[model samples]
Target chain A: MTKLMIKEREVVVPGDIIAEGMNYLPSTGTYRQGQHIMASRMGIMRLEGKVVKIIPLAGKYLPRRGDVIIGKIIDVNIMAWRVETNSAYSAMLSVKDGTSSFVRRGADLTRIYAIGDYIITKIINVTSQKLVDLTMRGPGLKKLDGGRIIKVTPTKVPRIIGKEGSMVVMIKSLTNCDIMVGQNGIVWIKGEPKDEILAVETIRKIEDESHVSGLTDKIKNFLESAKR
Target chain B: MAYKKRSDGRKFDELRPIEAKLGVIARADGSAYFKIGNTEAYAAVYGPRDLYPRFLQNPEKGVLRCSYGMMAFAGSGDRVRPGPSRRSTEISTVTQRALSPVIDLDEFPNAVVDVYIQLSQTDAGSRCAGICAASMALADAGIVMKDMVAAVAVGKIDKTMIVDLDYEEEAFEGEVADIPIAIIPSSGEYTLLQMDGRIEKEDLMKALELGKEVCKKIVKIQRETIRENFKRSEK
Candidate 1:
C-alpha cells in the first residue's frame, strides 16, 4: 500500500525527485502541479517545501447524507422545529420525521423538542441552497435539555474529536463528562459538578487553539493534569 | 466661535475611539464585528464560488456583492427589520466599489463574493465603518487582495473640513457636504466614493486629501486588528 503525504495545500508531482527518500506520492490519486491538496476526508494537512509530510484530517462530525446531529430547536411552528445548524442555514426536523409514533391532529408537538431542546439526529440531506434536513432515530440520538451548550468553529470539531473516537473517549474517561458533540459545532457537556467544568474548559481551550499543531498532546496534558 | 458638541464630547474634527473584533461569527468563512464609539457593524464574507441564478454573476471575473443594512433601532431611537433599503443599497454599492480595486478578483473566476454588513449601532459614517468592517471580514476569510481597504468620511462643516463625523455634529445647523471614500492608501486609489451636499472644488480636493490621511491611520488600526486576530488564532 503506497501513500503520499500532502502538505501546505499542495501535493508533489509523482516521478519528481524529492530530495532522496523524503516522501513518495500516494498511489490512489494522480498529482498535478498547482493542484490543491484535497482533504480526502476532513483533516489538517502538513507540507514541507512542496513535499507531503503529516496529515491529521481524520475526525468525525463528518456531515453525511442521513446522518443525525443533535440540533437546538430554535423555532417552533405548525410544521416542524426550525433548527439552527450553528451555521448560516438552519435545518428542519419535521413533525412527521419526529417519530414513527403518532402525533394527534393539532397536538402541540412542542412537547417533543421545545425551544432550546437539543435533539440528536442526522443530516437527511443538504440542499445547494444550504438548507439541511434532520432526523432523530439513532443510538444515543435524542432530545437534550438542562445542559450547557458551547459553540466553536465548526471546522475545528474534527480536531476536538481527535482520530476515530479516541479523543472524545479520552475526554469522557478523564472528566467522566457525558459530552455529545453535534456535527453543527454545538457541544453538550454534562457530568459531576467539577468534572463538567473541567471538560467544558478543556473543550473551549481546544476551540481557541484548534488551528495549531500538536493539539492532541496539549489536550492529553490537559486531561492528565485535570485528573491529578 | 460657534462650536458644536458630540454625544461622546468629541470635537467636530475628532474621531471616536475605534474598536474592532475579527472572527466574531465563528461559522462564516470570514467575519468581523467593529465599533467606532457607538456606531457598530458586523461583516461576514461568503464564497468565491458560483453565483446563484437569481443574482447577476460576472463572467470574466468574480463579482463582488455587498449587502449593507441598518437595524431600525441602530439609530438614536426605534428598532427596524433586517432587510435591504435604499440607503443600504447605495452604501453597499459604494463599499463594493471601494473593495474592487484592492481585491484580486481574477483569482476567483466565474464566482461571486458576498459581503454581508449588518449595522448594530448607527451614528454617522456607518457606511465608512461598514467598509472597514467588510475589509477586515475579507481578510479574515483569507481572501487574497492586493492591499487593505480603509475608509473614513470627510466633510466641510462651517467652512472647515473635519475627518470622521458623528450624527449630532453632522446634523448641526450648517451647510455640510460629506464625502465618504474607501481608499487604498498605499496605491492612492479610490474604490468607494460618495458625496452629499456640495463643496467648492478646492475644498473637495482638500477633503479628499484628508480622507486619504484618515484612511492611512485607519489602515494601520485595521492591520493591527488582523494581526491581533492572527496572534490569538495561533494561541
Candidate 2:
C-alpha cells in the first residue's frame, strides 16, 4: 500500500514525492517522477496545497452596464453604425448618440467617422439578450487611427494598465511612446519605430508574467535597462 | 434532394474534419471549443459552488443547469438575437438532462453546476454536438464525472443511413427523418433523444445502432482533442 503523503490541492511538480503507500492511479497531468515524487493531475508546479493553472487567463470583455470601452466602427447603416466592443457583444452607435451637430442634405456618415476608426465610448445599456448601446459624448471619448493594434489576454489588461494608469504612464515616459490600453485588451501604440517595438515587447512581457509576484519592480528594472 | 454537397462530392451525412479544444476559456472553471467544418461551439463550466438561492437548492443532489445560446453572427445569413429564445431554452433543458446522468451530482449536494454553451456557427446537429462539448468542458474544469458523453446526428439520405448532417441536408426530405442523439458510449446510456420526421421502428433502431458506432468514434476524437489542447496550453 502506497502511503498517503499529501493533502488535497497540494502543489506537486514533475518529480514531487506524491503517494508513498497508497493504491491510487495518477489522473491526467500527473507523471511518476524518479520513483519518488509524482507530477500533479493539474497544471502548475505545486508546493504546499494549491493547484496552479499557470496559463494565460481568458475571457470575453464583459461590458459592465456602465463602463467605458474603446471600439472600432465595423459597419454603418441608416440609423446606426455597428461598433465591435472588446466584449462578447457589439454595440450600436446611434446618430443621436454621436455629436449633436448636423448638416443640410444627404450627409455621408463616413465623413464623420469612416470605417476602421476607433472611438472611446461608454456603454449605456446592456440587455439580457446581450444588446449593447453606446454613447460617444463623454470625457476622453473621441476618434483614434494611424496607430497599429495588438491584442493581449483580456484579463491581463487591468494588470498591464496598473492602478490609475501609473504603470502605463511610466512605460510611456521610459519608451517615449504614445500608448492607449483598451479595456478589451487591444493596445494601440504609436511612437518612433524603435520605441514602439520596445514598448510592445515590454507590454507582452508584462502580460506573460502578470501572474507572478513582484512584476512592477521587474517592469521598472526592464524600463531602466531599455532607457540605457 | 441534397441541398449542398462538399467539394469532394461526399454526401451531406459526411462530417467535415472535426477538431476540439479544451480549456479554451481560462477564466471559466472548465471550457472547450469544437469545430466541425466551419460550425463551431464553445462550452464553459462553472460550479460545485454555493447555490444562489434556496429554491434552486437540491437537498439530495446538486442541481445542473445548462444554458445554450448562439452568437448573433453565428450563421452566414444574418445576425441573430444574442439572447435566449424558446429554441435555446429547450436546448438548454435537454442538454442539462443529457449531462446529469454522467455527473456524480450527489457528491456536491446543495451546490450548482452551470454549463454555458455558445454556438459560434450553426449547422445541423449543433445542439447534440453542443451537449457533447459541454461535457468535455466540465471534465476540463476538474469537475468529477462518471464518463464522457458524445453526440452526433444520423440522417437518412438516398434511403441509406448517414452519420453527421450539415445545414442544407437538414431541410431535405431524406435528412428530415434523421435523429440526433447524445450518449455515453462507455456505459451505453442515452443522454438525449429527438427526431422530427417519421421512419419505421426498425429504421429508428438502426439509427440508434449506427449512432452508437458514430458516438464511439466521436468519443475517441474528443479525448484526443482534449489531450492536444492541454499539451498546447503548456507551451
Candidate 3:
C-alpha cells in the first residue's frame, strides 16, 4: 500500500513527510525511514512514476564532471595551480591541463593563471573523496578580464539559463552586456557600469522567479518596462 | 504551602510565546533567531567548507563544531562573563552532540560545519533555546539532515511538573528539578537530556512525557518558519 502525504510539487523542509508505505521509492533529497519517506533537505518535491525525489533549491556548489564553471585561482605551484571552485573541495589545474602549448618543465605558473585571476574552466574529474581536476583546453575556456562578479543560489543556475539558453540569451541581448554564468553560481558581467547593473538585476530577478511559470514573457516585460 | 498556582499564570502544559525568524545574518550560510518567553538565542551556521589546522581534519567525513556564549548582560542573576566558561563549554559540547545525529556530513570529506550560538537574553532554558536555534540554522543552511530537532525545558516544581520552566520557577524556594531536553521529533529520539535536582522515577517519566508533547509543539513552529522562509524568498 502507498500513501503520499504531500502534493506533487510541494515545498518541504527536512523531516517533512513526503509519503508513507513501501509502494513508492525515495530518491535524491529524500530518504526512507521504516515505512515513511521523508524529505532530508529543503526543496521542492518531484514525483516521477513511483520515485519521489526532491530538487534542492539551495546549497553550496559541489563539483561534477563536464560542468563548465568559473573558479578563482588561489595558489600557484610548480605542478599545478590550486583553484577555488566555489565548493567545499578545492580543484587543481595541472600544468598539462593549464594550457594547450608548453615549453619547459618548470615555468612561472603565475604568469599563466595568477592567484587573483578568475578563469572559465571545465571539471574533468571528481574523485569520491571530492578531489577535483580542472582543464582549460576547451572553447570559451580562458581567463576573465576585469568584470563585476555576483553570486546566486547554485541550484538556480539551470533556471538562470532557461530552456536551451533562451533566458540568458535574452538578457544578454536586452542589456547589450557580456555575461557568463557558472554552474557553481558565480556570474561575471562586463559592460558599461549601468548595463552591468541591469544585467545583474535581471539575473537576480530570474533567480527569484525561477519557480513561476511563464517566466520568459515576464522577464522580457520587466526588462522592457525598466528600460523606459 | 503546595505549588498552588503558576507564578506566571500559565497552564502547567503551556510554553512561552515563541518567535522565530530565519536568515537574519546575511553573510552566514544560514542563520536564525529564536525567542521563548524572556529567553532569546541567535545561531549562525557556516561551512561544509575547508577546515584548517591540518591536523584536526577528518578524512572520512565533515566535523561539526559549535560555540555557545551569552552576552554579559543576558543573565537573570549576576552578569555572565565575556568568554567561554565551564558552563558555556559544556553546553556547546552537548549542543554539538545533540545536533549531530540528524546531519549527514559524509558527503563533505575534509570539511567542517561550524555553528555559533549566542544568547542575547536569558530567563532560564537558554541552552534549550540555543539548541532549537542551532537546529533551525543548520537546516536553513541546506545541510542534509534526516530529521529536525526540537528542544525545551521540562521539570518538576514541588508536586507540579511544568512544560517550560522560567527563571522565577527555577528559583522557587521549594523542591525544584529542572530538565532540559532535545528530541528528534520524527523518530522520538532523545539527543539531549540533562537534569538538575532530583525526582522520583515515575515523576521523571511523566515529566519526560510532557517534554515529548512540548517538543512536538516546538517542531511545528520550526517547520512552519522554515517553509515560510522559502516562501518569502520566492518573491
Candidate 4:
C-alpha cells in the first residue's frame, strides 16, 4: 500500500521521506529511493496528482531561456558585453542583439551599456556549457537609470510579483514607486527617496514572509499601515 | 576493565550536549555553528561562483574544496601557530572528501563550492565536529544532497569502548583507540573513517555500531536547526 508520510506544503530537508511505495512519482527537488520518495533539498513539498515536487525556498538563481532577467554589465569588448545575471554563469549580449538600431562595427559600446550599469534583458539562448546569450531588443528591455536595485531570493519572485503582478502593483500604487522586479531576483525601484526605501522594504518583507499563507492580505494591511 | 567510570561521568554510549544553528554568518552564502561538548565549530560555504586560476576549473562539474582551521588560543597548552598546519591540511582534505559524496554540483560547471570550517574551541573530535558543521552549511546553501551527514568520534579507552571521547579521555593514561567517523543517516553509510591507536577487531566493530547510533542523534539536532531557521525567518 502507498502512503504519504508528509502533508502537502510541509517543509522538508534533504533525505526526508515524503512518501512510501510505488504509487507516487518524484518531481523537482525530489527523488525516488527504493520504495520511498525523498526530498533532495530544503523546500516546501507539493503534491499534484500522483507527482510529488519540492519547491526550493533557497539557493542561488539559475538562468533559463526566455527569462527576462536584470543583470549588471561587467565587461565590454568590441563584439559583445558580458552581463552578470546573479548566477554562476554570465551572459553575452552581442552587438547585433544589443539594440534594435544598427550598431556599427568598432562602435563604442560603452556609450550603450557600460560596466557597472544594470539592464533588463531577455535570455535568447542557454547552451550546454551553461553559457548564456541575451538580447536587449524586446519591449521594456533596456538599461535602468537612477533606481537602486535590491535582490531577493529568486525562488520567492512569484510571490513578490503575485498573480498577474497584483502584489507588485499594490506596492507601487501605495508607495508611488516605479518598481520592476526581474525574474533573476533583482528589483529596480525609482521614485521619491522615501518611497523607494518603502518599496524596497515592502518587497523584502514579502520575500521573508512568502511561506506564510494568506500573505496577500497581510501585505495589503502592511502597506496600508506603512502609509500613515 | 581499568576504565570503570568516565572522567566526565558520561555513559560509554553517551555524547556531550550539542547545539546547532544555521545562517549564523550574514555575509556567507550559507553558514552554520555546531558545538559538541567544549569543542565548537563554525562552517561557512561560499561560491558555486566563478572558480579562479582557470586551470583548476573542472568543465564537467563544480569542485568542492574544504579548509579547516583553528585559532591560536583554541586549544590548551602552548599557543598554536596560526595558519594552515600539516594537521589542518590533512583534516581539510578528508572533510572535503567526506562531504563530496553527498552533494550534487553538476549544474555548476567550472564553478567551485568552498567550505571553510573554523574551530574556536577544542576538547577532541574537532575534525568530526567540523565535518558535521560543514555538511549542514552546504545544505543550508541550497546544495542538493543525497542526505545529511552526521559525525562523532567513537573510540576505546583501556578496555572500555566509548561513543564520544573528550580531551581528557583522549589523553587518558591507558591503551586508547580514537576513531573519528561520519555517517550518512538515511543510507547508514560511512563517508569518513579514521582511527588513532589500536583496538581489537571485535571491539572496533562494536565501537562503529555505537558511533552510528550517536550520529543519528546529531543528525536530528542538525535538521531541527534548519527547520527552526525557516520558522524564525517566516515571521
Best by DockQ: 4
Model 1 lDDT tens row, A15-55: 22112232443222222233222222122334444444323
Q: Which ten residues in a row have the lowest lDDT in candidate 1 chain A?
A: A11-20
Per-residue lDDT, model 3, residue B172, is 92
Docking class of 2: incorrect
Arranged by DockQ, best first: 4, 3, 1, 2
Docking class of 4: medium
Model 2 iRMSD vs. native: 10.5
Give the per-residue lDDT digits (tens) of candidate 3, residues A37-129: 999998899999999999887678889999999999999888899999888888999988989877387877787888989999999999988
Query: B110 in model 4: Cα distance from truth in Å?
Result: 0.5
lDDT of 2 by residue, A147-194 (tens): 667877666887788888878998998988888887767888889989
Per-candidate TM-scores read: 0.56, 0.52, 0.97, 0.98
Off by over 4 Å in 2: A1-228, B1-8, B11-13, B173-175, B233-235
* Candidate 1 chain B lDDT trough over 10 residues, lowest sum: B1-10
Worst 10 residues of 2 chain B by lDDT: B226-235
For candidate 1, write residues B14-119 as lDDT tens digits. 6788998877996677788878867899999986555778357555567888999998678777676667767677778888888877665554444677899999
Query: How well is each residue in B1-235 modelled by candidate 2, as lDDT tens digits?
Result: 5545443467544566788887788778688887876678999887655577678877677789899998888876888887888988998998998888867655455667789999988877788779878877876665545567888888665566667777766666544576878987655888888886777788789888888887877777776675555445333
- TM-score for the A-chain in each candidate structure: 0.72, 0.73, 0.95, 0.98
Rank all candidate structures by their TM-score, best first, as comma-separated numbers. 4, 3, 1, 2
Clashing pairs in 3: none
Would you give me the overall lDDT of model 1?
0.70
Backbone N/Cα/C clashes per model: 14, 10, 0, 0
Candidate 3: DockQ?
Answer: 0.76
For model 1, what is the alpha-carbon lDDT of residue B48?
59
